[model samples]
Target: MTMELCYNPAAGERGLGDLYLPEHPEHAPVALTIHGGGWSAQDKSSFCGVSQFIASLGWAVFNINYRLTTIAPWPACGDDCLMAAKFLLDGEVPEFAGLDRCKLLICGGSAGGHLALMTGLRLPPNRVAGIISISGIDELTSDFALHSFRYEPFFGGEPTEEKQTEANPLQYLRPDSPPVLLTHWDNDQVVPVESARRFRDRGRALGCRVDYYEYSTEDEGHGIWIPDSKPHRLYPHLETELTRFIESVRPENPPCPTK
Candidate 1:
C-alpha cells in the first residue's frame, strides 16, 4: 500500500487529503471518505484507519479535510467535498490513475455523512455508484439537528425552514439518485435513528434503492456503530455490510490486461 497527501489549491490548505492506493490497482474502485466532527472539529486523519481498511479491499480511498465552519459556513464543507470529487474525476491525480471513476462511492459518518449526501445528491446522475451514511443527520430540522450546539454555528445562527430544508438530505431524494446505505445505532444518544428510517422510506418511495441497517448495543452495554471503537467486535460485520452494498451497486467492468 502507498499513501500520499494531495492538496486542492483552489480550496486552500484546509482542502487536503491522504490518498491511499493499493499495490495492485488495476481496475480498482475509489471511495471518497469523509471524517465526522460536527463539521468543525475533525480532520482527514480521523478516518485514516477506515480509509486504510477500505484501501485494503482493492479501493483507492481519498480521505479528505474540508474547511470547518470556523472558517466558513453552510455549503462550504459540502462544496469542498464536491471539489474533492472533481479533483479525482479530473483524472490528473497520479495515485488514482487505476481507479474506475464510474465506480466511485462517497462515505462518512455524522457530519461527514451529511456532506456525503449533499455531494452525492448534487453529482451528475450515475457518476457515483452509491453513498454510505453512518449516524448521519438526514433531516436538518430534527430536534437533535436543531438543539445540537455543534450545528448552530455551522448553520449560521438559528435554524430556519429554508436553511433546514436546504441541508436536509431527505428533501433531495430523487428517482435517479444513487443507491444509498445508511447505518445508525438504535440506541444513539445523538442523532435519532428515526431520521435514517425516514430517509430510507423517502428514497424507496422515490423508486431508489435504499438500504438501511440499524444496530443496537443493549447486549454490549454501548452502541458499537462507529468503527475503531473499543471492543470492535462489530466492526467487521459493519464493514462487510458496507463492502457488499458498494460492490452490489457498482457496474461490472470487463477484465483488464495484466500490468
Candidate 2:
C-alpha cells in the first residue's frame, strides 16, 4: 500500500508544522511517530524521512508535531502529544481509513521515547498496539530531582509534582500494557542505563510483555548513535516487529491481547 500524505487539515499550520502522512487508504495498522529534541527543539519533518520509511513496510505512518517548548512550555507539549494521538484515532484524521483504529503503535527516540512511554500510561491498554523506545528517558521525574539533569530548562525549571506524575511512565504500572521493546546502550552517557532497567522491571512486574535490547558500546553514547546502525539494529527491526504485532492483534485475528 502507498503512504498517504496530508496536513492536520484542522490545525492547518497553526497547531504544528510540516507534519506528513502516508497515502495508503486502508486500515493497515498505524504508527504515530514523535521526534526527540529535548522537548524544546526538533521538528516533525526531521523524522518524516523515518516515518516514510516505516510507511513502506505495509503500515500507515503519521508524522506528528507537538507544541515545542521553545514556542510553548512543558504541559503544552505533552498535552499536544496526547491531543495529536486523540485526533488521529478518533476518525477525524483521514489518514489510513480514520487512524487505523485496529492496530496502533508508538515509536520514538530519546525525548520522543519519554513521550511514548508516558502516553502509554495515560491511555487505555488497548488504545495502542505496542511501543518501541530507543534510548528514551524513562526516569524523567528522578532526573528532574538530580542537579545534573539535562532537560531542566526545557521542563520549565522542574515540572510541578502533578506534571511529574503525569509525565513519568515509571510512576504508574498497567497490567495489560501492550508489548514494549526498549533499546539501550549500557555505556552511553546521556540518558543513563538505569532508565531501561527500571522500565523493564516495572513493565515485567505489571505483567506487560517487555523485550529489551542492549547495544554494544564499541561506539554510541549520549544519544541513539552507532548502536542504532548495526546490521541487525533496533531502529530497522522496529518496522518488521510492529507488523507482526499488528497482524497478531487484528481483532478478527488478534493475538491473545497481552495479559
Candidate 3:
C-alpha cells in the first residue's frame, strides 16, 4: 500500500512523500529514495518505480520531494532530505509507526545521490544503515567548471572554495561512516566516473566499507538503474548487489523483528 503524507507540513507539497509499505511491515527496514534532477527538477514521482522495487524486497520505501533550487538554493534541498529521514527515524508519522528506524537506508540517483551522501553522513552516527549513490558528485569544486550551469543555480552562484568543500560529500568520509554502495557508468557525461572511484578509494583508505560498481558500457550512461523505455527495469545485478549491501548493514540489535 502507498500513502502520501507531508513530512514537514510547513513546507506543504515540497515536503510531501509517498510511503510504500511492505506486505508484512512491522519492524521492516525503511529506505528513503530521493529523485535526481540536478537538485532543481523532478519529484518523488520520478522514484516511484525504484521505491516499489525496494518495497518488494520487504523494505518500506519513502520517496520524497524537496524544495527545488529555483525556490531555495544551497542547503535547502539537503535540509529537506535530512528532515525526511529524521521524520521516519523519529516515528513522527503514525503510518510508519512500526517500521525499523535503526535500519533506515538512504538511496538516490545523480544529484539526489549527492544529497543522500550528505544527509547520511551528517545525521547522528549509527542512524543510517547504508547509503547508495548512483552517478553522484563527490567533490563539488573539481567539476564546477563542467557543471557550472547546474551547480551555480544550486549553490546560489559560483561557490567559494569553502562552500564547495562544505558541499562535497567526500569531505564527510570517516572511519565510522555508514557503508556505501556507489555505481557509475564509465562513459557518464553528466557526473564523471572518476568522482565515484575517488570516493570509494578515500572511503576504503579510511577503513570505511564502500562497495563500488562501474558499468564499462556506454549504453547505461547516467541512470543505469532507470531505463528510458523500461522505467521499472533495473540494470542487471543492481538488485542483487543492493540486497546484499542492505543485508550486510542490518543493525545488530534492531529495535524489533519483522512481524
Q: Compute each candidate's TM-score over C-alphas.
A: 0.89, 0.78, 0.93
Instruction: Estimate candidate 3's RMSD in Å.
Output: 2.4
Residue pairs whose backbone atoms clash in candidate 3: none
The residue-by-residue lDDT of candidate 2 on 1-259, one tens digit each, is 3334333444444255332344543545667777877776776755665566666665566667776776666776667667766655554444334335554677777788888777766667777777767678876644565524555555667556776666677775678777787877777566777888888988898788888777664555443432534222334444455456545544333323222
Candidate 2, overall lDDT? Answer: 0.63
Cα RMSD (angstroms) for every candidate in the order listed: 3.5, 4.7, 2.4
Question: Which residue pairs clash in candidate 1?
Answer: none
Candidate 2 has its poorest 10 consecutive residues by lDDT at: 250-259
Query: Which whole-number lDDT from 0 to 100 does residue 108 have in model 2?
Result: 73
Off by over 4 Å in 2: 1-14, 17-25, 145-151, 159-163, 222-259
What are the Cα lDDT values of the candidates? 0.76, 0.63, 0.83
- What are the clashing pairs of model 2? 3-22, 3-23, 4-21, 4-22, 4-23, 4-24, 248-255
Cα misplacement distance, residue 11 of candidate 3 (Å): 1.9
lDDT of 3: 0.83
Tens digits of lDDT, candidate 1, 1-259: 6565555676676788888886667777778988887888888777777777777777778889998999888888888898888776655656766577665688887788888899888887667778998778766656455456766798778766777788888888889999899988886676777778888888998999889888866532225445446322236667888878876875567522211
Better of 1 and 3 by TM-score: 3
Q: Report the poorest 10 consecutive residues by lDDT, candidate 1.
A: 219-228
Where model 1 places Cα greater than 4 Å from the true spot, the runs are: 143-148, 219-222, 225-234, 255-259
Report the C-alpha displacement of residue 167, candidate 1, in angstroms: 1.1
